[model samples]
Target: MLNAGGTPNISGFLVDAFGKHLVALPGSQRALPGGTAAQPAQVKFAPEGDELLVTEKGTQLIDTFSVGFTGYASPPTPHASSGVTPFGFSITTRGYAIVSEAGSGSVSSYDVEDGKHLNSISAATPLGQSAPCWLVTTGDGSFAYTANAGSGTISSLRIAADGTLSLLSATAGRLSAPLDMALSSRSKFLYVREGNGAVSGFRVMPDGTLEPLGSVTGVPPGAQGIAAR
Candidate 1:
Protein backbone atom coordinates (compact mmCIF):
# COMPACT_ATOMS: atom_id res chain seq x y z
CA MET A 1 0.00 0.00 0.00
CA LEU A 2 1.16 3.56 -0.76
CA ASN A 3 1.08 6.29 1.83
CA ALA A 4 -0.73 9.63 1.53
CA GLY A 5 -2.54 10.09 4.82
CA GLY A 6 -2.01 7.28 7.33
CA THR A 7 0.53 4.69 6.37
CA PRO A 8 -1.47 1.59 5.32
CA ASN A 9 -0.17 -1.97 5.48
CA ILE A 10 -2.27 -4.97 4.54
CA SER A 11 -2.35 -7.53 7.34
CA GLY A 12 -3.54 -10.38 5.11
CA PHE A 13 -2.31 -11.91 1.90
CA LEU A 14 -3.07 -10.17 -1.38
CA VAL A 15 -5.38 -12.27 -3.53
CA ASP A 16 -7.54 -11.83 -6.61
CA ALA A 17 -11.17 -12.63 -7.33
CA PHE A 18 -10.32 -16.31 -7.53
CA GLY A 19 -8.33 -16.21 -4.29
CA LYS A 20 -5.09 -16.69 -6.21
CA HIS A 21 -1.88 -15.78 -4.43
CA LEU A 22 -0.14 -12.60 -5.54
CA VAL A 23 2.99 -10.89 -4.44
CA ALA A 24 2.51 -8.09 -1.95
CA LEU A 25 3.40 -4.47 -2.65
CA PRO A 26 6.88 -3.72 -1.34
CA GLY A 27 6.95 -2.10 2.11
CA SER A 28 3.14 -2.03 2.43
CA GLN A 29 1.60 -0.57 5.60
CA ARG A 30 -1.45 -2.02 7.29
CA ALA A 31 -4.72 -0.05 7.25
CA LEU A 32 -5.79 0.57 10.79
CA PRO A 33 -7.63 3.09 12.91
CA GLY A 34 -5.64 5.43 15.08
CA GLY A 35 -4.49 3.48 18.14
CA THR A 36 -7.07 0.74 17.62
CA ALA A 37 -7.18 -2.65 15.98
CA ALA A 38 -9.22 -2.46 12.77
CA GLN A 39 -12.38 -4.54 12.72
CA PRO A 40 -13.82 -5.11 9.27
CA ALA A 41 -17.06 -6.97 8.75
CA GLN A 42 -16.70 -6.87 4.99
CA VAL A 43 -14.13 -5.74 2.41
CA LYS A 44 -14.83 -5.25 -1.31
CA PHE A 45 -12.29 -4.18 -3.92
CA ALA A 46 -13.09 -1.36 -6.36
CA PRO A 47 -10.83 -2.05 -9.30
CA GLU A 48 -13.10 -0.19 -11.70
CA GLY A 49 -14.09 2.34 -9.04
CA ASP A 50 -12.33 3.89 -6.01
CA GLU A 51 -14.54 3.33 -2.96
CA LEU A 52 -14.69 0.72 -0.19
CA LEU A 53 -16.97 -0.30 2.65
CA VAL A 54 -16.37 -1.57 6.20
CA THR A 55 -19.15 -2.48 8.58
CA GLU A 56 -18.82 -2.11 12.34
CA LYS A 57 -21.36 -2.62 15.12
CA GLY A 58 -24.64 -2.20 13.22
CA THR A 59 -23.58 0.59 10.86
CA GLN A 60 -22.05 0.26 7.40
CA LEU A 61 -19.52 2.92 6.36
CA ILE A 62 -17.63 4.01 3.29
CA ASP A 63 -13.85 4.37 2.96
CA THR A 64 -12.44 6.42 0.14
CA PHE A 65 -9.21 5.67 -1.65
CA SER A 66 -6.54 7.36 -3.67
CA VAL A 67 -4.62 5.04 -6.06
CA GLY A 68 -5.36 1.36 -5.41
CA PHE A 69 -6.82 0.30 -2.04
CA THR A 70 -5.15 2.47 0.57
CA GLY A 71 -6.21 4.57 3.54
CA TYR A 72 -9.08 6.99 3.14
CA ALA A 73 -8.61 10.69 2.41
CA SER A 74 -10.50 11.32 5.63
CA PRO A 75 -12.52 8.91 7.80
CA PRO A 76 -15.13 6.39 6.75
CA THR A 77 -18.53 7.63 5.50
CA PRO A 78 -21.43 6.23 7.62
CA HIS A 79 -23.99 5.15 5.03
CA ALA A 80 -27.07 4.33 7.11
CA SER A 81 -28.44 4.23 10.66
CA SER A 82 -31.38 2.80 12.62
CA GLY A 83 -30.23 -0.50 11.26
CA VAL A 84 -31.56 -2.82 13.93
CA THR A 85 -29.20 -5.28 12.31
CA PRO A 86 -27.63 -5.07 8.87
CA PHE A 87 -27.11 -8.52 7.41
CA GLY A 88 -26.08 -7.68 3.87
CA PHE A 89 -25.91 -4.96 1.21
CA SER A 90 -25.84 -4.61 -2.59
CA ILE A 91 -24.82 -1.80 -4.94
CA THR A 92 -26.71 -0.86 -8.06
CA THR A 93 -25.31 -0.41 -11.54
CA ARG A 94 -25.43 3.38 -11.03
CA GLY A 95 -23.30 3.24 -7.81
CA TYR A 96 -26.15 3.71 -5.39
CA ALA A 97 -26.36 1.40 -2.35
CA ILE A 98 -29.17 -0.78 -1.03
CA VAL A 99 -28.35 -1.98 2.47
CA SER A 100 -30.14 -4.85 4.21
CA GLU A 101 -31.56 -4.15 7.66
CA ALA A 102 -31.97 -7.50 9.38
CA GLY A 103 -33.44 -6.01 12.52
CA SER A 104 -36.27 -4.02 11.01
CA GLY A 105 -36.22 -6.39 8.06
CA SER A 106 -35.98 -3.43 5.65
CA VAL A 107 -33.37 -2.12 3.29
CA SER A 108 -31.91 1.40 3.62
CA SER A 109 -30.64 3.53 0.76
CA TYR A 110 -27.71 5.90 0.79
CA ASP A 111 -25.73 7.97 -1.64
CA VAL A 112 -22.75 8.48 0.69
CA GLU A 113 -21.87 7.62 4.23
CA ASP A 114 -20.84 10.29 6.73
CA GLY A 115 -21.13 10.42 10.49
CA LYS A 116 -24.77 11.42 10.11
CA HIS A 117 -26.81 8.40 8.95
CA LEU A 118 -29.44 8.90 6.29
CA ASN A 119 -33.00 7.65 6.31
CA SER A 120 -33.09 3.93 7.13
CA ILE A 121 -35.81 3.09 4.62
CA SER A 122 -34.85 4.17 1.10
CA ALA A 123 -36.58 2.94 -2.00
CA ALA A 124 -39.79 4.68 -3.10
CA THR A 125 -39.75 6.84 0.09
CA PRO A 126 -38.92 6.90 3.77
CA LEU A 127 -40.85 5.84 6.92
CA GLY A 128 -43.16 3.68 4.84
CA GLN A 129 -41.23 0.49 4.11
CA SER A 130 -40.78 -2.64 6.15
CA ALA A 131 -38.48 -5.61 6.79
CA PRO A 132 -36.04 -6.28 3.95
CA CYS A 133 -33.84 -9.35 4.46
CA TRP A 134 -31.78 -8.76 1.31
CA LEU A 135 -31.89 -6.65 -1.83
CA VAL A 136 -31.03 -7.04 -5.51
CA THR A 137 -30.54 -4.08 -7.85
CA THR A 138 -31.19 -3.93 -11.56
CA GLY A 139 -28.55 -3.24 -14.15
CA ASP A 140 -29.69 0.37 -14.49
CA GLY A 141 -29.78 0.69 -10.67
CA SER A 142 -33.04 2.62 -11.00
CA PHE A 143 -35.01 0.06 -8.96
CA ALA A 144 -34.54 -2.59 -6.26
CA TYR A 145 -36.48 -5.18 -4.24
CA THR A 146 -36.48 -6.37 -0.65
CA ALA A 147 -37.34 -9.88 0.57
CA ASN A 148 -40.03 -9.07 3.10
CA ALA A 149 -40.06 -12.44 4.85
CA GLY A 150 -42.09 -11.00 7.69
CA SER A 151 -45.14 -10.67 5.47
CA GLY A 152 -44.07 -13.54 3.21
CA THR A 153 -43.67 -11.36 0.12
CA ILE A 154 -41.45 -8.85 -1.60
CA SER A 155 -41.50 -5.04 -1.27
CA SER A 156 -40.79 -3.30 -4.56
CA LEU A 157 -39.64 0.31 -4.48
CA ARG A 158 -37.95 2.87 -6.69
CA ILE A 159 -34.76 4.52 -5.50
CA ALA A 160 -34.59 8.30 -5.15
CA ALA A 161 -31.82 10.66 -4.18
CA ASP A 162 -30.86 11.45 -0.58
CA GLY A 163 -31.64 7.81 0.26
CA THR A 164 -35.38 7.97 -0.27
CA LEU A 165 -37.80 5.56 -1.99
CA SER A 166 -40.95 6.23 -4.00
CA LEU A 167 -43.43 3.36 -3.73
CA LEU A 168 -44.41 2.36 -7.18
CA SER A 169 -47.92 1.37 -8.18
CA ALA A 170 -48.93 -2.32 -8.31
CA THR A 171 -47.32 -4.13 -5.40
CA ALA A 172 -46.09 -7.63 -6.09
CA GLY A 173 -47.98 -10.73 -5.04
CA ARG A 174 -47.45 -12.53 -1.74
CA LEU A 175 -44.32 -14.53 -1.02
CA SER A 176 -44.12 -16.74 2.02
CA ALA A 177 -40.89 -16.28 3.97
CA PRO A 178 -39.07 -14.73 1.06
CA LEU A 179 -35.42 -14.46 2.00
CA ASP A 180 -33.58 -13.41 -1.16
CA MET A 181 -34.03 -12.69 -4.86
CA ALA A 182 -32.11 -12.16 -8.08
CA LEU A 183 -32.67 -10.02 -11.18
CA SER A 184 -32.12 -11.36 -14.65
CA SER A 185 -28.91 -10.39 -16.39
CA ARG A 186 -30.95 -8.75 -19.12
CA SER A 187 -33.02 -6.95 -16.47
CA LYS A 188 -36.23 -8.40 -17.79
CA PHE A 189 -37.06 -10.92 -15.08
CA LEU A 190 -36.74 -11.79 -11.39
CA TYR A 191 -36.64 -15.06 -9.45
CA VAL A 192 -37.30 -15.29 -5.74
CA ARG A 193 -36.91 -18.12 -3.24
CA GLU A 194 -39.76 -18.34 -0.82
CA GLY A 195 -40.34 -20.48 2.24
CA ASN A 196 -41.55 -24.05 1.79
CA GLY A 197 -39.08 -24.60 -1.03
CA ALA A 198 -40.87 -22.66 -3.72
CA VAL A 199 -39.32 -20.48 -6.41
CA SER A 200 -41.35 -17.59 -7.85
CA GLY A 201 -40.66 -15.88 -11.14
CA PHE A 202 -41.92 -12.48 -12.21
CA ARG A 203 -41.73 -10.46 -15.36
CA VAL A 204 -40.08 -7.16 -14.55
CA MET A 205 -42.03 -4.36 -16.23
CA PRO A 206 -40.37 -1.19 -17.48
CA ASP A 207 -42.17 0.93 -14.87
CA GLY A 208 -40.50 -1.05 -12.01
CA THR A 209 -43.64 -3.02 -11.26
CA LEU A 210 -43.68 -6.81 -11.02
CA GLU A 211 -46.04 -9.13 -12.90
CA PRO A 212 -45.92 -12.63 -11.56
CA LEU A 213 -44.69 -15.12 -14.10
CA GLY A 214 -45.50 -18.03 -11.75
CA SER A 215 -43.45 -20.40 -9.62
CA VAL A 216 -41.07 -22.98 -10.91
CA THR A 217 -42.29 -26.58 -11.03
CA GLY A 218 -40.47 -27.86 -7.95
CA VAL A 219 -37.24 -27.03 -6.12
CA PRO A 220 -35.41 -28.67 -3.23
CA PRO A 221 -36.28 -27.87 0.35
CA GLY A 222 -34.66 -25.03 2.31
CA ALA A 223 -34.28 -22.87 -0.79
CA GLN A 224 -32.70 -19.60 0.32
CA GLY A 225 -30.67 -17.93 -2.48
CA ILE A 226 -30.66 -17.75 -6.26
CA ALA A 227 -28.76 -16.32 -9.27
CA ALA A 228 -29.57 -15.93 -12.97
CA ARG A 229 -27.44 -16.00 -16.09
Candidate 2:
Protein backbone atom coordinates (compact mmCIF):
# COMPACT_ATOMS: atom_id res chain seq x y z
CA MET A 1 0.00 0.00 0.00
CA LEU A 2 1.21 3.58 -0.76
CA ASN A 3 -0.08 7.14 -0.76
CA ALA A 4 -3.34 6.07 0.90
CA GLY A 5 -5.22 8.81 2.76
CA GLY A 6 -2.52 11.39 2.01
CA THR A 7 -5.03 13.72 0.47
CA PRO A 8 -7.88 15.54 2.14
CA ASN A 9 -10.27 13.44 0.10
CA ILE A 10 -8.34 10.15 0.62
CA SER A 11 -6.15 8.25 3.08
CA GLY A 12 -3.08 6.55 1.53
CA PHE A 13 -1.21 4.05 3.64
CA LEU A 14 1.79 1.76 3.11
CA VAL A 15 1.20 -1.27 5.25
CA ASP A 16 3.42 -4.37 5.29
CA ALA A 17 2.31 -7.82 6.39
CA PHE A 18 5.40 -9.11 8.16
CA GLY A 19 5.02 -12.16 10.40
CA LYS A 20 1.62 -11.56 11.99
CA HIS A 21 1.51 -7.84 12.57
CA LEU A 22 0.12 -5.54 9.89
CA VAL A 23 2.67 -2.80 10.55
CA ALA A 24 1.91 0.61 9.13
CA LEU A 25 4.59 2.17 6.95
CA PRO A 26 5.49 5.80 6.76
CA GLY A 27 3.72 8.05 4.25
CA SER A 28 5.59 10.47 1.95
CA GLN A 29 4.26 12.93 -0.62
CA ARG A 30 5.11 15.97 -2.75
CA ALA A 31 3.18 18.89 -4.26
CA LEU A 32 2.98 17.22 -7.73
CA PRO A 33 4.21 18.36 -11.15
CA GLY A 34 0.70 18.85 -12.50
CA GLY A 35 0.08 21.42 -9.72
CA THR A 36 -3.32 19.90 -8.97
CA ALA A 37 -2.24 18.24 -5.70
CA ALA A 38 -4.33 15.21 -6.68
CA GLN A 39 -4.08 12.02 -4.61
CA PRO A 40 -2.01 9.02 -5.62
CA ALA A 41 -4.41 6.58 -7.21
CA GLN A 42 -2.11 3.57 -7.73
CA VAL A 43 1.36 2.08 -7.07
CA LYS A 44 3.64 -0.86 -8.15
CA PHE A 45 7.02 -2.42 -7.27
CA ALA A 46 9.75 -2.80 -9.85
CA PRO A 47 10.16 -6.23 -11.47
CA GLU A 48 13.94 -6.24 -11.09
CA GLY A 49 14.06 -5.32 -7.41
CA ASP A 50 12.50 -3.39 -4.55
CA GLU A 51 12.11 -0.11 -6.36
CA LEU A 52 8.59 1.27 -6.11
CA LEU A 53 6.69 3.38 -8.65
CA VAL A 54 3.53 5.25 -7.85
CA THR A 55 0.90 7.15 -9.84
CA GLU A 56 -0.27 10.47 -8.46
CA LYS A 57 -3.61 12.20 -8.81
CA GLY A 58 -5.38 10.02 -11.37
CA THR A 59 -2.25 9.01 -13.29
CA GLN A 60 -1.11 12.54 -13.98
CA LEU A 61 2.51 11.67 -12.88
CA ILE A 62 4.80 8.99 -11.40
CA ASP A 63 7.17 8.75 -8.40
CA THR A 64 9.66 6.14 -7.13
CA PHE A 65 10.83 4.91 -3.72
CA SER A 66 13.48 2.56 -2.26
CA VAL A 67 12.48 0.03 0.36
CA GLY A 68 14.09 -0.76 3.73
CA PHE A 69 12.96 -2.78 6.72
CA THR A 70 12.55 0.16 9.05
CA GLY A 71 11.03 2.19 6.24
CA TYR A 72 11.42 3.07 2.62
CA ALA A 73 14.15 5.39 1.43
CA SER A 74 13.43 8.60 -0.39
CA PRO A 75 12.03 8.27 -3.93
CA PRO A 76 14.52 8.38 -6.82
CA THR A 77 12.83 11.43 -8.28
CA PRO A 78 9.52 12.55 -9.70
CA HIS A 79 9.11 11.04 -13.15
CA ALA A 80 7.28 13.01 -15.81
CA SER A 81 3.69 12.41 -16.99
CA SER A 82 1.87 11.33 -20.15
CA GLY A 83 -1.23 13.38 -19.26
CA VAL A 84 -3.06 10.03 -18.77
CA THR A 85 -4.68 8.60 -15.74
CA PRO A 86 -2.09 5.99 -14.61
CA PHE A 87 -4.31 3.48 -12.91
CA GLY A 88 -1.92 0.51 -13.06
CA PHE A 89 1.73 -0.46 -13.73
CA SER A 90 3.75 -3.50 -14.87
CA ILE A 91 7.50 -4.17 -15.07
CA THR A 92 9.21 -5.59 -18.10
CA THR A 93 12.21 -7.92 -18.11
CA ARG A 94 14.23 -5.10 -19.67
CA GLY A 95 13.91 -3.06 -16.44
CA TYR A 96 11.09 -0.66 -17.27
CA ALA A 97 7.96 -0.28 -15.23
CA ILE A 98 5.26 0.19 -17.85
CA VAL A 99 2.57 2.42 -16.36
CA SER A 100 -1.05 2.51 -17.53
CA GLU A 101 -3.20 5.62 -17.51
CA ALA A 102 -6.81 4.46 -17.74
CA GLY A 103 -8.23 7.91 -18.24
CA SER A 104 -6.45 8.70 -21.51
CA GLY A 105 -5.77 5.06 -22.36
CA SER A 106 -2.01 5.47 -22.70
CA VAL A 107 1.20 3.98 -21.30
CA SER A 108 4.42 5.74 -20.20
CA SER A 109 7.92 4.29 -19.80
CA TYR A 110 10.72 5.46 -17.50
CA ASP A 111 14.32 4.59 -16.76
CA VAL A 112 15.66 4.93 -13.23
CA GLU A 113 17.81 8.02 -12.84
CA ASP A 114 19.88 8.75 -9.74
CA GLY A 115 16.97 7.24 -7.82
CA LYS A 116 14.69 9.70 -9.62
CA HIS A 117 12.98 10.20 -12.96
CA LEU A 118 15.61 11.14 -15.52
CA ASN A 119 14.22 10.05 -18.88
CA SER A 120 10.87 9.07 -20.45
CA ILE A 121 10.10 6.75 -23.32
CA SER A 122 8.68 8.63 -26.28
CA ALA A 123 5.48 6.99 -27.55
CA ALA A 124 3.52 7.82 -30.70
CA THR A 125 -0.30 7.53 -30.43
CA PRO A 126 -1.99 6.35 -27.24
CA LEU A 127 -1.72 2.62 -26.38
CA GLY A 128 -4.39 -0.11 -26.11
CA GLN A 129 -8.18 0.20 -26.15
CA SER A 130 -9.83 3.44 -25.18
CA ALA A 131 -9.82 4.11 -21.44
CA PRO A 132 -7.76 1.05 -20.43
CA CYS A 133 -7.82 0.17 -16.78
CA TRP A 134 -4.62 -1.91 -16.56
CA LEU A 135 -1.98 -3.59 -18.71
CA VAL A 136 0.79 -6.22 -19.03
CA THR A 137 3.94 -5.98 -21.14
CA THR A 138 5.98 -8.64 -22.96
CA GLY A 139 9.32 -10.01 -21.84
CA ASP A 140 11.47 -8.23 -24.43
CA GLY A 141 9.45 -5.02 -24.16
CA SER A 142 8.35 -5.44 -27.73
CA PHE A 143 4.59 -5.42 -27.04
CA ALA A 144 2.03 -4.17 -24.51
CA TYR A 145 -1.58 -5.26 -24.07
CA THR A 146 -4.36 -3.69 -22.07
CA ALA A 147 -7.90 -4.23 -20.80
CA ASN A 148 -10.08 -1.27 -21.77
CA ALA A 149 -13.02 -1.44 -19.41
CA GLY A 150 -14.68 1.60 -20.78
CA SER A 151 -15.09 0.22 -24.33
CA GLY A 152 -15.72 -3.35 -23.19
CA THR A 153 -12.81 -4.62 -25.27
CA ILE A 154 -9.06 -5.36 -25.29
CA SER A 155 -6.43 -3.40 -27.24
CA SER A 156 -2.93 -4.19 -28.45
CA LEU A 157 -0.02 -1.87 -29.22
CA ARG A 158 3.60 -1.98 -30.26
CA ILE A 159 6.14 -0.21 -28.06
CA ALA A 160 8.42 2.18 -29.85
CA ALA A 161 12.11 2.71 -29.21
CA ASP A 162 11.46 6.17 -27.81
CA GLY A 163 8.66 4.79 -25.61
CA THR A 164 5.95 6.17 -27.81
CA LEU A 165 3.10 3.88 -28.96
CA SER A 166 1.42 2.63 -32.13
CA LEU A 167 -1.80 0.69 -32.18
CA LEU A 168 -1.73 -2.63 -34.00
CA SER A 169 -5.13 -1.77 -35.35
CA ALA A 170 -7.62 1.01 -34.99
CA THR A 171 -9.74 -1.30 -32.81
CA ALA A 172 -8.97 -4.25 -30.53
CA GLY A 173 -11.97 -6.40 -29.69
CA ARG A 174 -15.06 -6.92 -27.58
CA LEU A 175 -14.38 -8.14 -24.04
CA SER A 176 -16.04 -8.25 -20.64
CA ALA A 177 -15.83 -5.47 -18.11
CA PRO A 178 -12.04 -5.76 -17.97
CA LEU A 179 -10.29 -4.33 -14.92
CA ASP A 180 -6.79 -5.85 -14.46
CA MET A 181 -4.67 -7.99 -16.78
CA ALA A 182 -1.83 -10.52 -16.49
CA LEU A 183 0.61 -11.92 -19.06
CA SER A 184 2.50 -15.17 -18.97
CA SER A 185 6.25 -15.29 -18.57
CA ARG A 186 6.62 -16.79 -22.04
CA SER A 187 4.18 -14.19 -23.41
CA LYS A 188 2.21 -17.04 -24.94
CA PHE A 189 -0.85 -16.52 -22.75
CA LEU A 190 -2.87 -13.59 -21.37
CA TYR A 191 -5.67 -13.22 -18.87
CA VAL A 192 -8.41 -10.71 -18.04
CA ARG A 193 -11.04 -10.50 -15.31
CA GLU A 194 -14.33 -8.68 -15.49
CA GLY A 195 -16.44 -6.69 -13.07
CA ASN A 196 -19.38 -8.92 -13.92
CA GLY A 197 -17.68 -12.08 -12.57
CA ALA A 198 -16.16 -13.56 -15.71
CA VAL A 199 -12.54 -14.74 -16.11
CA SER A 200 -10.94 -15.44 -19.46
CA GLY A 201 -7.68 -16.82 -20.86
CA PHE A 202 -6.32 -16.12 -24.32
CA ARG A 203 -3.62 -17.51 -26.57
CA VAL A 204 -1.28 -15.09 -28.28
CA MET A 205 -1.01 -14.59 -32.01
CA PRO A 206 1.73 -13.30 -34.30
CA ASP A 207 -0.06 -10.04 -35.11
CA GLY A 208 -0.71 -9.33 -31.40
CA THR A 209 -4.28 -10.44 -31.41
CA LEU A 210 -5.99 -12.80 -28.93
CA GLU A 211 -7.75 -16.19 -29.29
CA PRO A 212 -9.92 -17.18 -26.43
CA LEU A 213 -8.59 -20.13 -24.40
CA GLY A 214 -11.27 -20.48 -21.71
CA SER A 215 -13.51 -18.55 -19.33
CA VAL A 216 -15.12 -18.88 -15.90
CA THR A 217 -18.05 -17.53 -13.93
CA GLY A 218 -18.50 -16.00 -10.42
CA VAL A 219 -16.80 -12.64 -10.94
CA PRO A 220 -17.69 -9.52 -8.96
CA PRO A 221 -21.26 -8.57 -8.20
CA GLY A 222 -20.90 -4.92 -9.23
CA ALA A 223 -19.21 -2.67 -11.78
CA GLN A 224 -16.21 -2.02 -9.55
CA GLY A 225 -13.24 -4.44 -9.75
CA ILE A 226 -11.52 -6.86 -12.21
CA ALA A 227 -8.40 -9.07 -12.32
CA ALA A 228 -6.32 -11.28 -14.66
CA ARG A 229 -3.83 -14.11 -14.31
- Candidate 1: regions farther than 4 A off: 1-49, 54-82, 113-130, 161-163, 222-224
TM-score for each candidate, following the candidate numbering = 0.64, 0.75
Q: Which candidate leads in lDDT?
A: 2
Score each candidate by Cα lDDT.
0.55, 0.63
Report the C-alpha lDDT of model 2 over 28-131, residue by residue, as the tens digit: 44334333475666666666445666677543667776645444556345655664666666766556666667777676666654346536764324754577
Q: How far is candidate 2 from the true structure (C-alpha RMSD, Å)?
A: 4.1
Positional deviation of residue 75's Cα in model 2 after best superposition, in angstroms? 4.4
lDDT of 1 by residue, 78-185 (tens): 443445555445665445556666555555665533322333445323323456666776777777777776667676777765446565532465766676788888
TM-score of 1: 0.64
